[model samples]
Structures are given as C-alpha cells and as structure tokens.
Target chain A: MNHVSDHDADHDSVYDGLLGGDDSQWAFGTDFEDPLAGVDTTLPEGVDGAALAAYCLMLGDDALVLSHRLSEWCSNAPDLEEDIALANVALDLLGQARLLLARAAAADPSVVPVLPEGSPVPREDALAFFRDQDAFRNVRLVEGDRGDFAVTTVRLLVASTWRLALMQRLVTSRDAVLAAIAAKAVKELAYHRDHAARWVVTLGRGTEESRRRTEAALATVWPLRWELDRTHEVERTLAADGVAVDPADVAAEVDVLLDQVLAAAGLEVPDVKRTGGLGGRTGRDGVHTEALGKVLAEMQSVARAHPAGRW
Target chain B: MSAVATVRTGYADPRAVAARVTDPEMPMLTLADLGVLRDVEVEGPGRVVVTITPTYSGCPAMATMRDDLVHALTDAGWSDVEVRVRLHPAWSTDWISDEGRQALREHGISPPGAAPHRDGPVPLNLMPTRRALTCPRCASPAVEVVSEFGPTACKASYRCTACLEPFEHVKEI
Candidate 1:
C-alpha cells in the first residue's frame, strides 16, 4: 500500500466528495499518518512490546480476515435490509481491526515510535509491510472459513460471545490502551453476539431444512472452539498482568451460552472430535488457511494499486 | 435608530445551539437529548471544540455525525472548529440522561430500564427468554418483541397490546 502525504491538495477534494462537502474536513487528519500515534502509551511494566504487539496482531488479523469474509455477502444477502445489516456488521468489525492493528503497530518497538516529533506511518503501510502469518495471533475460529450464512452466524455467535467476555475483562487491564479499546469494543461486541444468536435461533427453529443446515454448521465449527480457548506463553504473561483474559476462564461461559442457544433452536450439541491437530494453533502462529492470503490480497489491492492516489 | 443597529438578531445560548444536532441513528433524539455531545467549548475567536464519543466503536453513523456537527457549528458561524473523539470511560447506555430517556419514551420507543440479565459474566439459569417490554406509547408493561432484530441495529420491533400499536424498543446493549 502506498502512503499518501497529508499535503496533497487533491486529497481534500476526493475526501470531500466521499464525505459530502467540506463540513467534516476538520475531523480527519491531513498528516496521513496512523491515528494511534503519540497518545501516551502505557504498557504494563516488564511486558515485552514486541510480544504484546504480536499478540494484538493475532486478534486484529482475526477480525480483519473475518470482516473481509463477511463483506463478500454484502449485496448478495437474502434481503435488502439484511444486506445493509450484514454490511454494517462487517464494517463494525473492520473498524475494530483497524484500531487493533494500529495499536499493535504502535506497541512494536521495531516499528517507529508514534510520537509527536516522530514520523508516524499510516496503518495501511505498516499492515502491508509488516510480518506474515507465522507472527499473527488470531484464533482459528475467525480464519477457518466462511461457509454459508448459517455457518457464519454460528461462528459469529461463538466468537462474539467469547470476545464480549474477553472485552469485559480487558476493560480493567493494567495496560491503558488495551483497556480503552476494550471499553470501546464491549458494547459493539454485545450487539454482535445478540445479532448472531438471534439468527442462530431463527434458522435452528425456522424449518426442518434450515434446522438441519444450522446444526450441520454448528457441528462443522465446533472443533474450532478448542483453538479459541488455547493460551500461549505471551497470553499467560499478559493474563497475569491483567492485560489479557485467561482463555480458559471464558471457555465455560462460552460453552454455556452456545449450549443454551443450540437448545433453544432444538439442535443437539455434537460431541467434540479432534481433527488436523498438527497446525500448532494455526492462527496464533500465523499459519493460516489460504483464505487469509486471498483476503489480504483483495483488501490491499486498492491501496496497492492507487499507491498515493487521493481518496 | 442608526443604520448599523437596523437589525436585531436573537442570540441563542450554546447549549440550545448544540441541542439542534440529533443522533443519526435515533432521529427522535438530539445529541444533547442523548448525552452524546459531552462538552462544547467556544475557545479563541470563532473556534469551537466539540468533544463526543460514539455509542459504539464501529457505529457507521459516527462519520456522518462528525460531518453533521461541523456543518451545524460552521453554518452557525463557528468555523474554526475541532471535533475530538474520546474513547476513555467509553460510552454506556447509562449515559442516556433522564431527559433523553423521556424523549425516547415520547417518541414511541421504549428506553432501556435496567441492564439485561444476559449482560453478565455468568450465564443466567433462566431460559433464553424475552422480558416484558413496557409500551413507550402507553407506559403499559404488556409489550412483546415481534422480531429480535428491529428497524435498526440498536432497536427491537415490538407490539404494544395495550395501545394496539407496533413500536421499536431500544435494545439495551
């Protein structure tokens, strides 16, 4: 992705068109730098900036990739309002990804410090140039696959519930940035969970045909739950420091919610069966499905093609 | 009277001026009515800084609102304006003031009463059940959710049996 200088005059025109008139020109930045720059970062004492950054990247990448998948359903949704709703949800997740990734980049010592005097690089540039999948920290649920609306809703229910739990815990993090982001994200994730749960129940109880599909979708996505609860050394450290939620603590809550949802829909929860155990936590390790590559390619395509083109 | 004093303009206070900006999602409520416009400071000459936070981090309407705010203030002749987005002590449904709540009730949308039982860390033993919604129109607690998702992401469709009317209930986040 090419970086555009804040000084370009044409940038203003295009932005105005997108935003409608010159009314909001003040809300955006002319500096063309990452928005997270130089805002008094306070990391927990003794925590490793690089590791923290990598951890954040894991979560951010999960949101980014899943958001991309959700966007594919934009105009193709079953109804017009639903199309708008899905797109809105996707954009919400995208906004979360942008903030998380920008925070990760800011936390990295290797990346230039985001200070008033320092040149802060745009998040797009950092995302484009930074580490690959091996360094990502997202769980398998977000990166696995986007099957159908049923599958997506199942995944969304589980992921959003778990994230809401995590975000609730994160609101009290010793690390201010994490806490602030969590504070902002908790309500949004709550809505997300409710939205997904509604769909899961609707489809599960709607018709025999729909119920079968919903159950199958739940079964297909169940295995990924293991990845969601797995914790690594960095996670453990952060958990100890109150900067991250213990994935284990959230597992029970997530299960109870899922079980209730499934029961309400009259679908039986399938017994857990392990598969493809060799990836060693694919998401946290940055060893993702080919789906991620395809997603990144499309996401970065426009910015890459335009380079520094205005708007 | 002198020609310079020919016209007398009514001057409205800043609070009254700021109250004219409404929430994009909840058209029935203004920013002041919703407690979103936390602070408005007129500093320096014609420069105004409005501090606002989003109801949620990814609310799509925020971008539109920031534009609306600038337009409202600028068109009112406060051109050197700055809009600051703050995320700390993040927005809560609790922030909706009593006035805002009353406005919502008057607008035929039920306001959030208390935090939902599903909002806690531990799952409630109760079955996933819908609570009795209070009718915004009649203040009668005989409402049922007709649909889980409503007209917008923040609302749920409801039918008030007492009033024999269909209305939207602002879902508690």
Candidate 2:
C-alpha cells in the first residue's frame, strides 16, 4: 500500500519550490524586468503627455476590465479544458494590462496617486487598484457582466477582433512603448480571437439548443459594439500625433472579420442598433456603466485596504 | 587589486551559466533552448546582466525565468546578477534551437512548426491551424487537437490517434 518511492523519502517535503524559505520573491512582484526597460520612452514631438496617458488608459482599462471579467470564469467554465483556456486568455490580457498601465504612469506620473512613503506598490499597481470608477476609461463593451458562456464568447470574439485590428496599426505608433506593446499584443489578440471564433462556430453549429443560445448571446452583445468604434477626444488627439489609432478607421475591418466569423457559423449579424452614452460622455470620458463600478470595487478592494500590501 | 587577481576571482562564463538554467515550467528546456535567453554579459568584476524575451505577452513564466536566471548566476559564483526583458522584435517560436526541439520531442511534446510570415495584418483563420507534426511518442502523423490551449500559454493539447496518447504541442506564435 506504500505509495512513497525512494526519491520521495529523500525529501522531507514535496512542494520544494512553493515551500522554500525564499519569501522575497513572489509572482507578479518586482522580480521581472520593467516592461519598458532599455526602451526610449521619450515623448514624441508635439504630443501632449496628458493626451498620451489618457489614450493608454483607455486601452489599458479595456484590457484590465475585460481581463477581470474573464478571470471570473476561472472555476465556473463549462469544462476543465475551457476553464484553463479562459484563464490563459485572462492571464495574457492581465500581462498586457500591466505593461500598458505602466506605460501610462510613465507617460504621466501625475495620474498616479501619492501613497505612503516606501510603499511597495508600483505605479501600475496603483493605477489599477486606486482609480475611482469615474476615473476609469474602459469602453462599456468590456465592463459588462459576464453573461452566459456563449455570451462571453461572443464578447471575446468582438473585443479581440477589434483589439487586434487596432494593435495591428498601433505597431507603427510614434511612441516606442506603444509600438512595442502593440507588436506583442497583436500576436496574443489574434490567438484569442481565433479561440473565440472557433468556439462561436462550434456552438453555433452545435445542437439546436446551443445554436439558439449562441444567437441570443450575440443579440445581447451586438449593441455595445458601436461604442468600440467611436473615437474619443483623447484618441483623436493622439491619432493626430501619430501615437494612436482612430478606432473609427479600424471599424470597417472589425466588421468584416466579425461578419466572416458569423458567416462561417451560419449565423446572421445581429441587427441591433448601436448604443450611446449620455450626451457623448462615454467610458473614455470617465463615464462608465454601472457594471464597471461593481468590477472595480472587487478588483480594487484588496489593494485599497492595504495600499502597501505585498504577497 | 591586480588585473590578474581580479580575473582569477571573477566567475566563469556568465552566458554558459545562464544557458544552463532550465525553464521553470518546461524543465526539459533551458532558457537558451527556449529562445528566451537573448544575451548574457559580464558587466564588471562580479556583475552579470542577462536579457530575455517572453514567448507571449502574458506569459506567467517570465517572472520565474527572471528569478531562475539570477539564482543560477549567483550559484555559479557571480555576486551581482540582473535580468532584463525586451519586447521589441517580439519572440518567435522559430528561435527555438534544434536541440530545444529535440528535448521537447523526447519529453512527449510536439515541437512547433515554422512561424507564420506576415506582410500585413494577421489573417483570421477559423479552421484549426494546420501544423505538420507527428506524435512525439508514436511518431504518428494522425494527430488531432484536443484543445487549443494547454496548461501553459504557449502550448496546445493534442491526441495521437494511432497511439491514443494525449500530448502537448508548443504552439507557434
């Protein structure tokens, strides 16, 4: 009945790496390099620092909020494999978020709040956890509640497709940091979009129940799609500086990609009308949906409780 | 201290030491084999700096890789070690060394095929990526993907029809 082998008896514990005495190094800590290290972070000519930082916030917040939504599906996915897949996608977006947030803080350190002396929190962590809901700049498409699995997949398909298009153009940004981040992001978002597209097709072509649910999910998510294409003032300003992509420019490409995916799945594009904000003040203008408040509360609670906390 | 004395006290080749540090997730492959250890330099007497690139933007193993590089160089008698990450000219699976591919194969994992070449936007392909690979265990060409994602960000799960064995494939980026 003995399961222990000779090798096992040689060690007093099995979790050598986890239980090691090295308490200084933790995941997502200061061990990794600065995402912008060695890169020329100088501002481009005639580009306002505030505008550039706001643009980064817009993209970074979108990733951070959607990543949080995806992470909520950690153990709740339909199956183990899918659970892992969603987690992987979430982790990728989180990584992108960290870099983007760091870039934002670097571009405009004033946007980051002043914390207690010797606080271990990096500016990126501060931005992610300390911002008020009214300060967040994420589009509503990403901040909505995680609907059913099918709905989530549809959202992912649309979000990643649009992001990939934006990132593709962002690779040529006048800002080196944005260009580097975009170069890395384009590859990751493509994979994410592909994963979502495949699932959409599978579910759409599955049993009648699955197809019906997939279509319903698309209908629920389609109206929010227009907000992704609306160009905000910060984006418009940065675009003029050659440091940002006008989402409006990429809207057509996103539509074509989405249409292709829907056509493959034998599903029609939902004829839902585009939703709007109150007097043109959208998420980019610090006006977010109620869902964003709930997401930010949960995401920022732990960090706010102990601004100096490190694990 | 004399120049000769300083040379005697200095550590062995930092690159050699760094190249031997295995990936924390894929222990079978060293950082060099994984194509992440981009450069290793002896900055001064005991200070060594290592450079690496992540296979994916959100790779969880990156921090671990950095820590391992520092630990390995320290253990090899270097007093000061630093790791830097580069994102430009983003990492590609094509950089995986031949020996790295062999190691993955021996570990029952399929090595990645050539990376996709892009002149413009990355085209969307709903169909499964067609990879020319064989089962690492049985060398069977009849293999199908079980899941597009594996336990790690850079891998995918596959099943060999001939041997009926599930395996992981290091997906091309």
Candidate 3:
C-alpha cells in the first residue's frame, strides 16, 4: 500500500531530499518571498519608530501567542469540522502575526535580536523565536492554555470581536503597511468572530451540560478581557499620530459587540473581577502570566536549538 | 535591437507568460484569473518584474505563486525576473474573473460571489454566509454548509442536499 516512490532508497529519511535537498528550503522553502516585499514600510512623519515598533510587537505577539494556542487544537477539537475551522483561524492569525512582526522589524531593526551571522533566520522569525518571555507584548488573555472547547470558543469570540473592531479603523492608518495589513485582516477577523460567536451560541443553547460548561468558561475568561482594551503608552502615542488605533477608543465598541453575541446566545456577560498585574504593569509592559513562558518555550524550542541550522 | 531581432531573441511578453501562472493551491485558476497578479513590467530585454497581491494575509500559496511566476517567466526567456508583492487595494474575491468562475464550476467547485460591500464597519453576522449558490454537480440550489473552513484557506466545505455530493466553495472575503 506504500504508493510513495522508493527511488531515493539510498536516503535514510523519506524526506531526506525533499524540496531539492536544500535544508534551508525545508522550513520556508527556497526563494521565499518577503511578505511585505513591495509594500512601503516607512514610518509616518514625526512618528517615533521605537514606539511604532513596540506597538507592532504588541499586536503581533497577541496574534502569534493566540495562534499557537489555537493551532494546538488541530486534531483535538470536538469534531472534524471544528478542528479544521480552528486550524484555519490559527493560520489566519499566524499570517497577520508574520506581517506585523515583519513591520516591527522594518520600523526599528534594533528591536530585532542579533542572531548569528548567516543564520538565515528571517527578521520576523528572529523576533518570534529569539525573544524571551519578558519581551512578548501580548495581553494575558491570549497567552493562556487552550482551555476546554467552551473556554476556547468564548476567548476566541471576545478576542476576535476586539481585533475586528480595531482592524476596521486601522484601515485608515497613516502607515500604509499597517493600513494594508488591517484592511485584509478586517475581513479575516470578521470571519473568526462569526465562527466563534456561532460556537458560543451553540454551546450555550445546547444541552444542560454544555450550557453549564459554557457559563463556567465565560466566568473563567471574563476576567482577562479587561487587559485587552487597556491601552499601552506606545499605543497612545501611535494613535495620537494616526499610526495606530487606540485600544481604549475601541473598548466601548468591543463591549457592545460582545453583549450582542452573548444576548443572541441567551447568555449574560459573566460577572468577574478584572485580572490585575503587578502594580501598574501588565502584558503590554512585558508582564505576562506564567503560562506565556510555557507557550514560548514550546514555540521557540526548535528554532532556538537551530539558530543557524536551516530548516 | 531591430523588431525582427526582438522577435527572434525568444523574448516572450512578460505579462502574458506571468498571467498563465496558475495558483498552487487552486490549480484551476491562473494568477490572472484569481486577480492576484497585479502588474508586470519589462525592465529591459531580459529583465522583467512582476507584482502580485496576496488573497489573505497568511495565505501560504503566496510563496508558491511568487515562485511559479519566476519560473514561468524565466522559462519564457526572461533571465532576470523579480517578483514583488503589493498589499494595498487588497485582493477581493470579486476580482475572480468570469472565466475563473466557469473553471471552478467545471471542476465541481463553486466560485465566489461578490465580496461583501462594507460602507462602514463590518457587521457581525453569525448566520452562515448568505449567497446564491447551487450544487456544482446537479445544479441544485439546495446545499448546506459542512464547514466554513475547507481544505484550503480560500474554500468552504458544503454538501449538496439534492445530489448528495460534497463540494467546496471559494468563500467571499
């Protein structure tokens, strides 16, 4: 039943010479095009590059961390349909993360870790893999483990709603690259939000057990929603400069959207205290939950081990 | 070079050759048919540049598309070929050509409808995508969604209630 060719019997591994045997081609493939190849990446006039870079990292890390979590649900989802759906959502977010991280590196190269010479690690890869836990800027909401299906669904619903709102306005960003990124992301986020919202309703209105678990999951995740809208100083600067959407500005909007989804699901927003970080510090300040360490450790293990090893 | 020399030099039209490059994921459609191939410019006798846009931010097919364009143009006699990606004016399903639509239907895949027109904020609708689509198999309008996500990022899985056959629909973004 093995239909695969055995022409390469001399090769120890089946994939030994995959993609022309170039090890570098194994990871991203040879002649990999830069995601932002022809896009203009210059900073807006009088805008602080460092702050923009930081802002990009904040958004990029959010997508990257949450994407990793979602991808973990690859085969573990409740059904085959749900499994493919989650993976698709993860892929969309991962794409957004790559572009944002690449933009961050373009805005300020200093933020990119100095990898070994001839490492062949792209700028975005270096930022994603080389950064320590203390350097990630994602909100604590997205860094946690892949909770139960209900938990994941609720978190996704909230996260996508917030992100969709932000991206809608980001289409007008002064920075063309960010604007372009947001324009495309807005559509994808809308789909992600729709998918999550539907699941939330299904879980809420399903059996009594499903409803109970959905309620419990909401309570578990509702606390982390606070950090999502809490704008960082970098975001404020970029927003003032018309280079970013102020997270605070979108707070009321996100709340209304979430309320609508919950209402349609015949569920109420869970009453929970806001999750607080060390006095005045939070994920935006690189103050993440302990869970982020585990997430990064798993994500960075392979790339860290082979800093210069292609593929 | 003289006009006769130019024709004899194996200098094929860069745009024409680049336009024939099909998408790696959806082989039924060319980059031109998918509207991903934005523009092509002949810099000199042997140098050419091709510009393309991604269907999605994280579309894995983009890398393949770029590679395919280079290969196609190179094989067509362009020695120095550069593929550049443009992000502005993001690619829309509306850009899929009429020919592309026919090709999809011929291959038992439903073509995308017009993209959602967003005048302001994109509204949150939990209902399934409301589109007028028929089963590519039996031409039956009765079909139900199997899943919003499909084997590829650009498609959605659905089954025809009439023919009882499964098919993929290119989702409108």
lDDT of 2 by residue, A1-311 (tens): 15567656777565556736563355444432466655567888888888888889989999999999999999999998999999989988998998898889988999998888877777888899998998888889999999899999999999999999999999999998899899988878888999999999999999999899999999889988888999888888889889999999999999899999999999999888877888988888888889998998899998899877643
**Candidate 1: where is the Cα deviation over 4 Å?**
A1-40, A78-85, A109-136, A198-206, A263-268, A271-281, A309-311, B1-19, B41-48, B72-80, B102-110, B116-143, B159-167
What's the best-to-worst order under TM-score?
Answer: 3, 2, 1
Docking class of 2: medium
- lDDT value, residue A16 of candidate 2: 57
Clashes of 1: 4
| Residue B117 Cα positional deviation in candidate 1, in Å, after optimal superposition | 8.4
> Chain B in candidate 1 has what TM-score?
0.77
Worst 10 residues of 1 chain A by lDDT: A112-121
TM-scores, in order shown?
Answer: 0.77, 0.92, 0.94
Clash count of each predicted structure: 4, 0, 0
Tens-place lDDT digits, model 3, residues A186-275: 988888999999988888889999999999989989999989888788888889899999999899999988898889888988889988
Interface RMSD of 1: 4.5
- The stretch of ten residues in a row with the least summed lDDT in candidate 1 chain B is B3-12
* Residue A193 of model 2, lDDT score: 95
| Residue A75 lDDT (model 3) | 95
* Chain A TM-score values, per prediction: 0.83, 0.90, 0.91
Maximum-lDDT candidate: 3
Q: lDDT for each of the candidates?
A: 0.69, 0.87, 0.88
Sliding window of 10 residues with minimal summed lDDT for model 3 chain A: A23-32
